[model samples]
Target: MSTDSTSLKLKKEIEEAADFLPLLGTDYIELYVGNAKQSALYYQAAWGFQPLAFSGLETGNKQSASYVLVQDKIRLVLTSPLKEGGPINRHIDKHGDGVKVVALWVDDARKSYQETVKRGARSYMEPKSIEDENGEVVLSGIHTYGETVHVFVERKNYHGAFMPGFKPWNPAYQPEGTGLKYIDHMVGNVGWNEMGKWCEFYAHVMGFAQLVSFDDKDISTDYTALMSKVMSNGNGRIKFPINEPAEGKKKSQIEEYIEFYNGAGVQHVALATDNIIETVKKLQQRGVEFLKVPSTYYDTVLDRVGQIDEDLEPLKELGILIDRDDEGYLLQLFTKPVLDRPTMFFEIIQRKGAKSFGKGNFKALFEAIEREQKLRGTL
Candidate 1:
């Protein structure tokens, strides 16, 4: 099939998928960490996240402490258990510091929950309204792959710093942002052959469409391989690329992640930046480390992706990868795992009219990842 025809077909499918539920965008991503206070400090200093809200002992919540941080459209809630013997503690013990909830902003939380539940989604939380002096916010949730969840948030009637249980947090230490605009996409690493199952769940339960698919042939390095499918909603506001390990000479990154994370879970969050060069420079200055691909990879990148707006020297110097589709091209870089376990990481991406994931760069990207796995002695 021609590139134009393929793009058109994918666009039509995406448009058709939007009729199920009305999702505005990603509201916030909540991570259950071991220490909310120290993690908040690390995010504020290293990732340029500004303190937004807090919910804990002072707020009369004796169970757990939650810290909310915001950078542009991205809001991160880092929560830690105040008391022992709870789900939060168990999650921390099992998965370490990883994403527990992916909240979506919607028009009506109740209707969203009803439609999805009626479509076979397991109910995680029924629609519940919480109010404060600001107003009222309704929230509902459903379980997704692994223990990860999708929470529907209806906040049009609220005007608070965050939600009802949280108060505004203004600390003396404030930092500048890294030009990350919003979440581009999030990738999930499922178990051996669970990618197709979760893909069906998203398609039938949540009304998402498969935008693209990659076999082991497309994503394989010499030592490792994996299969993935990209699922997107109608408005294209949310995208999830689900991956599972494929048979290979050595352990693939997907297998390594599932083994360390103890099960299927989120692998990485891709953050979008308008100016990736500037944003990556600032992140590097703040002690962020990205995977290093061989410099030879850049020698033929422009030849494949064609001409781009930014110069190649800076991108190559900073170890960013480039790929092109029918629409345009994209620049992306992956960081090493931010936690002690080689589980979750971050992807910094800048889309230059490209709607597709970085298919053309998968081999090089996976080769770089394999190098990291080798260093950790996991491959």
Candidate 2:
């Protein structure tokens, strides 16, 4: 087969795997920020991410700022600029607040690095070691997007809950956690004509394969549309869905993201919890505000989608939305813009049995976003 034909065939097989995405779980999500402390507080108080580790003035790593937060199975590292001129600062100035690293957990960092590089991947960093009382940790990285990277983490040598220096936070003000267990999927919005390029990068460079695809025709509305392709590793644990907006009567959400972000970058990080109602409630009390959906949405949810295993009352109370597909049902909710710029956000999701992105709810969810855009004068 021709090279392009071979790739297309491989992509088709990958997407059809469905529940077989082989990802172990999320290692850590690193965000480049202007202020690590403030962002840390925002996550802890609003999102219920607990203080898991710290490194900075207090820890003697003063070159840059860092904070580590954790939930049941998720770890988030917040890094910021300590100097006026630095790469982190440049990224923030260009792209606003967004994910810089989507680290993956592995048994052997060195091998993962060697294998991917041998497969035509461009190296971002060589495998290196960080030591502490728990043990040693090895890590490596590969470039993904404009200023975005995927890091390989080998923690077999460590025994701590998170990386070293992060003490178990017993903060009195910590927000209670929602049942979010791990990262379900992370979606990125790229510039026009960039989706296929990135998808190819994942396929040839990182050994990932495209799993599912949606063109503007599938995802677009009369006013707006975008194309997307989901790529995943052999183990479905890690999924990266790339998107690019198509011309529309009004600005689509992908277009808005590219505009505010100033280039191609992550649009949202969808974190998966086990119990969304508990998670969202804790998130709300802690200060995280979700995109407002009317209470009336719950009125016809059951009638429209049929019965789910979860109680409808609590879901309605928390403004969590549900949808179904031939595969199964999934519940999810979105947070309002999480950064100063209207760029990046978070999604709290609970997957009962469904493996698909909430396609059934995209219309409702996008309309909810449109409401927010109208208020911000961006619609």
Identify the leading candidate in terms of lDDT. Answer: 1
Go through the candidates in order and give each one's C-alpha lDDT: 0.91, 0.78
The TM-score obtained by model 2 is: 0.88
Candidate 1 residue-wise lDDT, 175-235, digit = tens: 9998989999999999988999999998998888889999989989888999999998887
TM-score per candidate, chains pooled:
0.96, 0.88
| Candidate 2 runs further than 4 Å off | 1-23, 164-175, 294-300
Q: Write down the worst ten-residue block by lDDT for model 1.
A: 1-10
Candidate 2 overall lDDT versus native: 0.78
Scored against the true structure, residue 246 in model 1 reaches a CA lDDT of 95
Clashes of 2: 15
lDDT of 1 at 271: 98
Q: Per-residue lDDT of 76-97 in model 2, one digit per residue for the tens?
A: 9998988788788888888777
For model 2, the run of ten residues with the poorest summed lDDT: 1-10
